[model samples]
Target: MGIKLLSIKNKFVAKCLLLTSTLALSGCDDWVVMSPFGDIAKQEAFLINASTVLMLVIVVPVLLMTVWFAWKYRASNKDATYEPGWHHSATLETVIWTTPLIIILVLSGLTYVATHRLDPYLPISRISEDKPLPDNVDTLVIEVVALDWKWLFIYPEYNIATVNEIAAPIDRPIQFKITSGSVMNSFYIPALAGQIYAMSGMETKMHAVINEKGVFDGFSANYSGHGFSQMHFKFHGVNDEGFDSWVSKVRSLDNQTLNHQGYLKLEEKTTGHPVTYFSTVGDNLYHDILNRCVDANTVCMDKQMHLDKHRAKNAVKHKE
Candidate 1:
């Protein structure tokens, strides 16, 4: 009987080991790649991994100890030591508390350094360990306006613009200065980077570079109005030649110049917006949106600031 029970236990252990190995092997494919860490996207991923591992260092041991203690102290284990009133152990207490403190300190230091070093708004340092970004390589600046249910992408460098679709050259750094037309929203491209908020009358900048050529989906992560569900865009990372060709194709459009009236019409809530091209855009139009003065003679945040200052001065004079 004892031999039979031992044999069954051994078989069960072997089967469990085999199952665990198979799961671990399959998990490799699902494991998120942290390799492409040269960019901001990967940097954020690295931070996440670092914090998670640090936390797990404490969590795993505690879990194992809990299970071990429970089994070892079971009523069936007649040989186990037990003293109900013995709880305090100064040495054990110091070790348990100090070890976690050390882990926290290390984690906090890493987090603090990474937070500043991996700031999304910061420009790319070195493209790769082997190659440095050329000083003459001008950063591509795209002004993004989050509309009700669509995205407006304006490339000031090429003097061309597109709606609901954005294309950029692979391995080239791109900076997005984003703002919303009305309510607050979050700009997210999961395959590229994390989400960044877009608030009305405020411009938020994000830096990212796609190393591989692919089409990634971008959307509003924050819940806005009714049409927010359909608010989506395509991010294409192509070769430099392909990007140039795309620019030329967009430039060749007949009705590229989008006047103020046309812009207002385009800003309305729409669903599954077809890719539209603009050959020409109004001068400093993107700047106008960033300043929250897309409409004519409308009070902007800067103007409001001035008005508040003037009122304060007048109030001080009256008090005197």
Candidate 2:
């Protein structure tokens, strides 16, 4: 029996050591959430770390107390106290209750500040800590459509569209107006900012800026269907000149135009779509998608709601 127990313990210890070594060898760079690139992500990381440390301030002492309690009150310890009338002391109660209350108050204030500062709808005030956004620099607007197992990005400024890829110049603020053609999905580019939802028939807004000049991964953080695992996109942050060159290169494609017809075709459910570009895209395409009118046969949500409201007003007048 002793030998069997020893053998099991040895195997368990070996497995634990192997797992720890594997994690250590991979390096922390793989954990992008802990190592942030953009200002929003960096703030989020700081908040996470701050909360963790705050909680640990209480947790570490309690864990040590537990160990100390076990040894102090052990059966073999002759110095252990025995008090049948042991009720909670005022000092102990105050320490236990007041400590948590103080921590909660601090956390509440921290959360409130962070929430407003990191509101996805709020435009970024500064590109970096030292640089305030200039009044002359325009915020780039990108309309995003989450299709079935794919993504479509439309740049209204240039009247161009792309699938499974998007780009912006470094330190330039971007406003993303997002909606869905099919099921709900989360639009997340971890290197740039946090996740925001894209819902059908309604538009959502997110504002963020990429500080780094590199291609990072963007994907649907929400699971929709079987093809959800393969849904991914690339977010490229380049220099101003490189962005201009990229836009020009896309314009040079010259032939493809994404109108409503093209959109319906692209809306079909498929997986693992490669990067595609459209030289021209129909105006108000995103507005149509937001109103659930990408298909000509479908009635737009706003128009239908307006009609319903008008009818209700007429009925009330007649009743009076």
Candidate 3:
């Protein structure tokens, strides 16, 4: 009876240790980039893992050999051969330089392939593993305006806009046209894909899609100003029906149209603004913003540039 009780106690202790180990490993899921929810992010995760494993092939062996050689060649061990004058060996020299060069070449090739393959401007070819984007499937276009301390997402197709919130249907590709209202900012959603810069008077593009249905956090990855720390928004991934419902809900809101006048107010320096929806959005609003002319009386940068060029030509013609 005594032996059986001792065995039971040991089993209980083993179970407790197993549970603790499992919990500790599960805590690592907090690394959102490694555990992604979108196809593009998954591809990025693959690249990270591949690169780490490739480097570890050399790193792990070198680290272990360092300790092993130190122990094996200790001064206390008289059996170890002394090589005070044997500094150079043809075989050792070949390996010392050749290994790192080979690794560099391989990594370079991988980086070259990944750079083009993962370019944000390139449209997504596949939605997820084994799922090629069908020709008939439509892509969602989102215009992202990085405001002073908030994010404004405009859905061109739906003619609706939202502040500090965005959403898209799962398994459908999303194309983002991003620009800043003021200074430069980085538009990032970790569970989606890489961060792309948003600059005033310039537009940047990023293509991505969500494979999972959940709420993710979106934020400015770069520090812009005093309110930079509060420049966070919510990104929702839902089904087609849910997306439509969300649009309907926004359309039903009493918020005014997001025109140049409205945008001027939004661009003011403020932080921690709650999600607000606008039923109507100005056409070519994003274009106007990209040109740094979201005000009624201001000339767009493109038009201003053209006028300047024409003026220069006229002045030269007069001289002639």
Candidate 4:
């Protein structure tokens, strides 16, 4: 009777899980991470899948053993062993310890390789698995700034900038130099690459290429503040000609220029921000922001650090 009740409870739990998974799958449009459009994301997805499978090898067996032990050692089971002196078995000890140790080693190796391979700071050299990044195509450099509830992208090559929307040519390598103007945030575009943290007065870098021509979601994955949820941007992967046209359109936005003063105004906290284009961005605007001297009255972090070092040296000389 006890065994029967346990079986019935297990069946109900299994049925509930199946139903939940079915419902979740029903609302899916695309498996953005699992089926990503870029080489970096695709490789990341592979690592994820491999890691999941490795975990399940240990998980499935442990789950099965748990149920087996529960049933085999049940109170009502007359066939169950009841030896008072039996505490440990060499075979059981070896199996339990060896299995997890092997899994850990395998997982550690996978993590080491994946960490270096998918490192955000490491520059990627290929577009896809077989296609190498061409020598003719110059790597597109996009300076990214995480604002209160929006994103700012500055294209130095074209002297153009945009807020909440960005474009790049498909199959061309793109490098991102990311920072935050307000608080710490994460730059994430699932179809392009993994999340890389963006922080104030510091810069992080990422390299990726988009193989498909489509608009993808880009956002801050970090819980920054009250307006964090509104920090979503559109990433456009277009053909070379389309990208040129998009740049031209941004350059055509009259009376839309992003300088130190304009950036200060744009950094204000807001929600549901619309896509904005800037005709021109001031030179070295991103570098100035990185050094933490966007405001005229503020001292740059670099200069401050240098001053501190000089003072320390003078103090040591005086002591001598």
Give lDDT for model 3. Answer: 0.93
How high is each candidate's TM-score? 0.84, 0.92, 0.88, 0.89
Q: By summed lDDT, which 10 consecutive residues of candidate 4 come out lowest? A: 26-35
What lDDT does the true structure give each of the candidates? Answer: 0.83, 0.91, 0.93, 0.92
lDDT, candidate 3, 1-320, per-residue tens: 99999999999999999999999899796788999999999999998998898899889989999999999999899999887887678998898889889888888988899899899999998999889998998989999999889999999999999999999999999999999989999999999998999999888999999999999988999999999999999999999999999999999976569888888888889989989999999878888998988887899999999999999999999999
Query: Candidate 2 regions off by >4 Å?
Result: 1-14, 17-27, 79-85
Give the Å error, residue 299, model 2: 2.1
Candidate 1, residues 1-40, lDDT tens digits: the string is 9999999999999999999999889967634344442256
Cα TM-score of candidate 2: 0.92
Q: Candidate 2 on 195-273: residue-level lDDT in tens?
A: 9999998889998888888888999999999999888999999999999998997788888899999998999999998
TM accuracy, model 3: 0.88
Look at candidate 3 and tell me the lDDT of residue 136. Answer: 92
Each candidate's number of clashing pairs is 2, 0, 0, 0
RMSD of each: 4.4, 2.2, 6.6, 2.8
Q: What is the lDDT of residue 229 in candidate 2?
A: 89
Best by TM-score: 2
